[model samples]
Target: MLSEPEVAKHCAALLEHFADYCEQMDEATRGYVVRLAWELIGDQMDRPSVRRTRRGH
Candidate 1:
């Protein structure tokens, strides 16, 4: 399992490489790609780390 710091480091690198990739794509495609990338990353980050139990036993 990766720690949060490791995830951040890899995500930073992924965004950097993604930027380079988007630059080489056609202008019409770059916008969609960037939006999709952000959506996916945002979803990943927004997910809860664990499922919570109810207050009652």
Candidate 2:
């Protein structure tokens, strides 16, 4: 399995790339992209995190 720090580094790089791509999108497209990303992230969250997200924490 990947080490935790390695995973974090890769995630950071991915976020950078995603941010750049999103910057090129129009407001509506960017909103959709963000919402889709949120849903995908929610799917991976543990129960407590999911609850906090649902509560808008």
Best candidate (score: lDDT)? 1
The parts of candidate 1 lying over 4 Å away from their true place are 1-3, 40-57
Per-residue lDDT over 1-57 for candidate 1, one digit per residue giving the tens place of the 0 to 100 score: 234888878877877887888868998788676666656566442347845445976
TM-scores of the candidates are 0.47, 0.43
Against the true structure, candidate 2 reaches a TM-score of 0.43
User: What lDDT would each prediction earn against the true structure?
Assistant: 0.67, 0.64
Candidate RMSDs in Å, in order, are 11.9, 5.7
> lDDT per residue, candidate 2, 1-57, as tens digits?
224777757766766777889878899988776665565444433446455434555
